[model samples]
Target: MTSAASKTFVRRLGVLLGAAGLAAPLTVAMGATAQAATSACTAGTGPYQAKAERFLGRTVDGKQSAADCRAIRDFQLDHGISPAIGYAGPVTWAVMDLVSQQRAAGDNPNAAGRCPVNKGRIACVDLTRQLTWIQDGKRLKSGPVPIRSGRDGYETRTGLKKIYWRSIDHWSTLYEVRMPYSQFFDGGQAFHSIDGSVWSAPGSHGCVNMRRADARSYWSLLKNGDDVYVYGRKPGT
Candidate 1:
């Protein structure tokens, strides 16, 4: 399979989890409570047993609701951490610690260079820890920012692509673009921050979501005719 296709499969199979409270991106369905709604933030867990049972394609009963599962996922995503599918692993814990440090720092050190491609610069989305910047010939730091991505079918398109144009302080995204520029692909997709809720649940209509602070930063730093790249979850559980 192609690398992108492979990555998608891996992400699906892996069943990566997020923190228990902070939301990022990723639709979650536990036992019965499946619905999409933004609400007050607090903190929490999904039914591990239910998740495992579902993995086997078997039905199971539980106290965990779809909201619970989504909340947990959102927590992880917003925090730049990943959850363990079955048992807690070292990597999961490490990601938690790293995410905590990053959140505390409140600055994206990764943005200190050029964009991954030779054309533009790089920026880090503090919310999801996903990087987006201009990629022309190399990577550079456009600015420090925050972002969230897809929960399901409309997962953010990653890898190398050129920025079609720019939209400063846009209503949807701080910056917008047309990527891949391939056949039958809609070029209106954009990269910006979230304006509604902080929960990282699966949301957005095919755009890369970010925090307003980060989005504004990107708006002020990046120029038109740059490149952008984003990296996120992959398949294989």
Candidate 2:
């Protein structure tokens, strides 16, 4: 026989877990409800979403399902993605691509290395991956975003650099173009969203080009004096 106070404490813990969606209560239709939650994507959806559905272990028909989002979020957590919103956003997609690339190449999918010592909010770039990740030293805050660095001629300088400047809407006088959410690390190289094909090509002259949304996110995350470490050679380099 348990004490009343002990029983109340357990019940309160259950409520907190339930509120956080950590544990669902014992519902009437646990079996049937499970099926409904794991919905398949319907037709007319983008191939990318279908890929995400499959990656999430959900039916890849073409549909939106909370179950899929939860799976995606869980995957993100395992991969060191932050917030774990469950939405297959730009950051998620970028990570997915990186994983796919690694799998295809028979390489390790967990592609993180030792971060810079004492570098708070470090921005890490894997040239081999063509990916960027922002983290507070050991903890990832955002990214694994697809990025484009200098092409054949003008290779983006590698090695560790510190962010020294930031601009919300900066126009590059050297390139004569607009660089949104620009965080400058190397002398003339910065991480900024550009109008180019970052998904398929390393199209930048030398600066890092990110997707518009990712640039916005980077702007919100990084600040001056943050360490930026660019490592590994870009694929096919």
For TM-score, the strongest prediction is: 2
Candidate 1: minimum summed lDDT over ten consecutive residues — where?
177-186
- Tell me the tens digit of each residue's lDDT in model 2 across 127-229: 7767777877566678667787877787788898999999989998887889998899998899999765574443577788888999999888888888898
Judged by lDDT, which candidate is best?
2
Over the full model, what C-alpha lDDT does candidate 2 score relative to the true structure?
A: 0.69
- Each candidate's lDDT (Cα)? 0.43, 0.69
- Superposed by TM-score, candidate 1 places the C-alpha of residue 188 at a distance from the truth, in angstroms, of 2.6
Alpha carbon deviation, residue 163, candidate 1 (Å): 2.1
Candidate 1's residue-wise lDDT over 170-195, tens digit each? 44233353222111112655666565
Candidate 2: 10-residue stretch with minimal lDDT? 37-46
| TM-score list, all predictions | 0.42, 0.54
Give the local distance difference test score of model 1: 0.43
Off by over 4 Å in 1: 1-98, 101-128, 131-144, 169-186, 234-237
